[model samples]
Target: MADAHRPDKDKEQDAVRHPAELVAFSKVKAGDTVIDVWPGKGYWSRLFSPVVGAKGKVYAYVPAEIVDMKSDPMGIAKAFAAEPGYGNIEAISDPLAQQPPPDMQNKFDVVWTFENYHDLHDSFMKGASVDGFNQAVFKLLKPGGYYIIVDHAAAKGQGLKNTEDLHRIEEATVKAEVEKAGFVLDEESKLLASTTDDHTLKVFDPAVKGKTDRFMLRFRKPAK
Candidate 1:
């Protein structure tokens, strides 16, 4: 279920705040198959639905553990099922450690992760490590498919050190890890950059909650 504290309407608007511009730059078009990983509150999922249109498909991939934590997982999934223009949309809750469903393998033109990469460390504590998550993303895309990530940025030298505490990761660390999965960094966008986010407070700290410094990375699965 959507977090009661985070209404669907608010979540929808927040999706428009920064990531929408990045998505536009991604050149996503009608008839493209897209996946929104860790689709918290279904914001990106909702956005992708219309962008993909009737002929295309959008899969909202939520980790199985999220569902196991509450009874509303299926309820949240069902909400998307009830939308009118989202006939091609689907909700998939697979264990984070596993690959995306076989039916989805090599099926997407784009896979997007937003404001959620830092949680990979948390996902690890739950048994699925970051490597597992990246590998799954790698396997789900076509050879030339796009994998886009946007997440809170840790201090330059912090590396992955405070990922668990601050829910942030070094951009360099993320770049290296994704490259190891055979993805090539295609582009970087500075639209979300903020010099004022001093990298000390937790992202959720009231002062910097909405304006946390972040890095945007676009990578592609190499074509054979």
Candidate 2:
């Protein structure tokens, strides 16, 4: 994390984001292939690229729905991948459907998305099936590979009710949905949790914007 090439702006948020601990928890190691789904601003991508090393690869996937948007997320991803010392990183786009391409199935060591799982349930994604998404994730990983999700926590039992409006989802809902896809719940972390976050306000509300009560979950595909 002390690498000089990282943007100063990204470094500033490390204290709260706990990139090192989360990376360790994910067990991403040198020579492992990783897919950083919907890697906005390339924050996690930047960290993963170095950890995965020259022999490793990091795919910064931009969902198909927003690939053509005015913001040009694909372009942003490409630009980040092209920066110095990031040769191991590449930018990939989602296919027309939310599901990953057939060639990508069973090909990765880790599939990780940070703070954007709730967006998959939002209308902006054009009704992408969360179940299909989870199943696709299951198929994408190699046996024993990891699936990591980090997102803001909503009130317990709220389920998808706050996903669109508050940009949060119930912790239990995520666990149930992902587990249905056949992943075993490996571990959960409170690294990003905030006791002061009452789980009522929108994640974007000024008071909670950067410090929302977030949940981190790790799921694993059985080697068998």
Candidate 3:
């Protein structure tokens, strides 16, 4: 958690993002292969690299739809991977609507996405099927592998109503969609919940921006 190489700006977010605690809850360890889905700026990937150590691997999965954006997420990931102390990291991308490549199937110990899960339901994703994305995550993990999602929480009973406008999704809605992919809901954490945010404003709204109420869930692929 105190890695000196991490950017000061990224470290400043530790209070709200809780990268250290999230890493521990995810159960990532040395020698475990991890896939970081939609790793904008390689935030989580950077955290995973050192924990996974020399033998372990971290693949930053950049959705094909956003690879060519002005920000060039793929380029950022690739460059970060090449820097000293981050050799274990690699950058990978696939069409948002497609499953992972055959070689990637059942290969990762953990598949993680943070603050971006609701984007899957938004048009910005270019019609990517939420179900298909969940299935792909399921396919990417080895048996008993964990899939972790940390996203802004919507008002109760709203389902997908606020996704596009508010950038949030009902917690139950996410659970239902993911469970449909055959994962078992293993645990959840209130680590990012907020008392001030009323779940009505967009996550980007200045008042609620970084302090939005969020949910963290851990789902496990069955070992059988």
Per-residue C-alpha lDDT of model 2 across residues 1-224, encoded as one tens digit per residue: 97777999889989889988999988899999999999888999999998999899999999887787788999999999999989999999875245657897788999999999988888878776778888888888999999999999999989999998899999999999999999999999998999999988998899998999999999999898
Q: Return the lDDT, model 3, position 48.
A: 96
Cα RMSD, each candidate: 4.1, 1.4, 1.3
Over 115-155, each residue of candidate 3 has an lDDT whose tens digit, in order, gives 99998888778888889989988998999999999999999
**Candidate 1: residue 173 lDDT (0-100):** 93
Stretches of candidate 2 off by over 4 Å are 96-103
TM-score of every candidate relative to the true structure: 0.87, 0.96, 0.96
The regions of model 3 sitting more than 4 angstroms off are none
lDDT of each: 0.79, 0.90, 0.90
How displaced is residue 105 in candidate 3, in Å?
A: 2.2
Cα deviation of 16, candidate 3, in Å: 1.0
lDDT of 1 by residue, 28-53 (tens): 78999987887766767777776777
